[model samples]
Target: METATIHDERTEEGRRLTLHGRLTVRVIEDISPRLREMEDDPVPLTLDLGGMKRVDTTGAWVLYRLVEHRTEQGFITELTGLTPRIEALMAQVGKANQMTTIRHPIRKRHFHLLARIGAWVEGGIYQFGTFLAFLGLTMLALVRALMHPRRLRWLAILRQAEVVGVSALGIVGLMSFLVGIVIAQQGAVQLRQFGAEVFVINLVGRITFRELGVLMTAIMVAGRSGSAFAAQIGSMKLAEEVDAMRTIGMPPIEVLVIPRLIATTIAMPLLAFYGAIMAIVGGTLISWLQLGIPPAIFILRLQEVVPLTDVLVGLIKAPVFGIIIAVTGCFHGMQVEGSAEAVGEKTTAAVVQSIFLVIVLDAFFAIFFTALGWA
Candidate 1:
């Protein structure tokens, strides 16, 4: 036999309904009048469906519609007498009021922020470790090169020099010229206040010969040529070309990197010299126009104020920066993972870390020169 019970209780101003046993569609139709009776009251609707044994989807749908009707009328539906499992099932089927019960959105946001910071710190550590590893390898390569000078391939070195050095000329020249013009204009304004506009030539010459020429050239190389080296090596790594070289019993350091290192070291100093010349030309032109210093006076002042040692110092930093750049590029290249995204990321890290190391090294040189009464 099938049996069901519907009980009603009266509060101070409202009625509560308790339903037991299976709530079929027919039972809901029979209880429509009782539901209508409670609809007139301003109190919340309480549906005690605790004894519900087996609810069909139709019963679940009916309960959802009742909850929606209560919500539209600004009355809350309190579902009491439900087992935890039934309550969970109701929530899962979208028949229960589960929307406003979520906890702690701020904690979720805080965790998200922490995750981002952790990722950034991890990346920083990896890049710093890569820089250190490259530094060690470069020192090793340098020792090997010195020990086996005959093994250094001159043809490969010259080819790399032609590629990295010769190809960099146009961009370096343009950058140097623009830098010189800006410096001259600034010096002209400052010197004019002191009735020393002619000294703009000395200002441009000393600044360029001392720092700007070498530093700008290094930065450009880091961006342009260093990125190229890293990307090329990274691509080779992805294609397993580096592995093929290894399989063929070729020393990657000797055949690939050593040649590049030698070429860039030789070429960087020469580029520094050319860059200094372009800067002087640009500064001279700017001084002629703004400071009223003729090309002859500019040349004489430049010769007088610019020590030959300043040019030597500028050129001296180039090879060191070049080695740093190349080694960093190769290290990050070799660290490339299997994915294209990883290759690109490591290549970018190489250039950024190279530029950072160059500036840091330059700062050390600046301090060293100042201590020696050179700057």
Candidate 2:
């Protein structure tokens, strides 16, 4: 219970503030009010700390502030009788305060903009790195399964295939059909004004076979199966089932991810081809009912107008889109931590990221094919 004693004395020379006893945080409450009322004269001041038996950062701060206030009034200050230990402590405290006093003159708006841009760039890099790592791990698992066929889980693959493909056929087909009908109606109306309504057959056939069919199918699967994959895996993560598999020397990637990834990849092309056929059927029906073109004539014209290249292009894009969707879903799922709220967030992110990547890949494919004279 060593109490601090601070005494200020003025003489013809200048002023002197004598500090003794334990000048630490505990003594601060007792010393504050009296010190605040002390004079801050614009003259040389002396701080005598030789009597001080103990000093902490708080006490040093108080001494530094008193010296600073007097110095700011066009005065000089000095500390006398400091041992090596106390001097070193005061030096460190002074350095800390000096850092706080330093400031760079920059516009606040520009500073904020730079901070935000930097944060965004950092986040982008982190996400890209994690995605590459996830992709590599998945590829390794697939390669291992390929090398050892017995390690592959056939039942799981079949089950996932059923979930990702067969169960989704009805909704995907119906949606593609409705979209095709809309396209045919719109194309026919526009072409009718030019006495070329029959060309609507070419429009529907080419667009559905080359672009809309597979693109729409990918989006549908992302919204349906990608979200499901994330929720399922995330739930497993929350239950520590993934950890258990790892503990038992079973690679969770092979057990959980391989089946889903392979199933989605295989299912995508089939779904895309099926969706294209359904879209063609819908367009043909619309042409027959609304435009008075017979279904047989529409199918005949579709065959004549749509080339094998367009179908090939759509099917080729399907597997890549499936890979993106599956990888994104599984990656987000494995990232899940904390509670069920995290599962919901990851599930939503899986759907959104899958759709975004599908569209971007579609754009690149379109450009690449066009440059290759396939457009």
Candidate 3:
């Protein structure tokens, strides 16, 4: 517990800090302020440690920092007359500090486009690998549930269905309705120029049934239900509830993910069909007001022009889109780690990735249906 002292002297050569007494914790604590004053001094510093009776890790670290700081600033710092033991202690401290002291990655001066692209591709590959693993885990859970139907949580599926489908009807219907109106108005205007304004009925019916209906519902569900899944599961992750379930021999995929997957998958086609109906109603209203078509005639024309094939196409894609949304949300949710901030980040990622994947799937379906002569 011996206290150390620093003797600061300035000469024509440089500044000198001479240590006296034992250089330990108490002494370092007391001399810290005095040590800091030397930081801005650009002149050479000579640390004379020979007078020190003893030194410890704390003392060695402080002295090493002073030397390192001055050296980094392009100023000279010399340690003179150190005993072999103290010199050895200082060397060990220097190595330890270099290993972990305020470690940060040094930024590169310039990165080429190819380097950035390579990094992006590497990250994407890693992400895809993780997603495939998650998919496999989910499939295993599905198989387990199929093998033992009693283990399946039907109540949870019903609850999630209400949340994902029933609760979402209002917004989906409203958005689809508004979108339908826009499609009708725009179609009527453009077709009017060619003396084919009545064709707007065909335009609205085919577009709603074939594409916009299910696609809009999927987008809405991705933003709403997808984000909710990520946030809900991610919060459980942060709370360690997921881990606790695992500790208790409960597989999270079977308990948490499968119910949601079933609910969304079943609810999506029904929701899409309902949304398409609402959109057709909206188009009907617009046709009456803007096109001078009676509701009766509009319905009759819509029935004649739009085939059952379009409805089948939309419904076929809906369940797949639903599966995409549920998997992305739950996958990203389970991926959350560290702090609460990660929950929000993964939630956003869930929504964005779900929407992006949904659009990509939609495009693929469009091409597929066209090749099958459905278009």
What's the lDDT for candidate 2? Answer: 0.91
lDDT of each: 0.80, 0.91, 0.92
Pick by TM-score: 1 or 2, better one: 2
| Pairs clashing within candidate 3 | none
Highest-TM-score candidate = 3
Candidate with more favorable, higher TM-score: 1 or 3: 3
Which window of 10 residues has the lowest lDDT sum in candidate 2?
A: 33-42
Q: State every prediction's TM-score relative to the real structure.
A: 0.68, 0.73, 0.76
Winner by TM-score between candidate 3 and candidate 2? 3
Winner on lDDT between 1 and 3 is 3
Q: Write the per-residue lDDT of candidate 2 for residues 1-375, one digit (tens) a residue.
A: 879887889978788888889878987888866655443656667778899998888877776677667667777788898878787876787788754566787778989999999999998799889989999999998998999999999999999999999999999999999999999999988999999989999999999999999999999999999999999999999999999999999999999999999999999999999999999989999999999999889888888999999999999999999999999999999999999999999999999999999999999999999999999
Clashes of each: 1, 0, 0
The local distance difference test score of model 1 is 0.80
Best by lDDT: 3
Model 2 scores a TM of 0.73
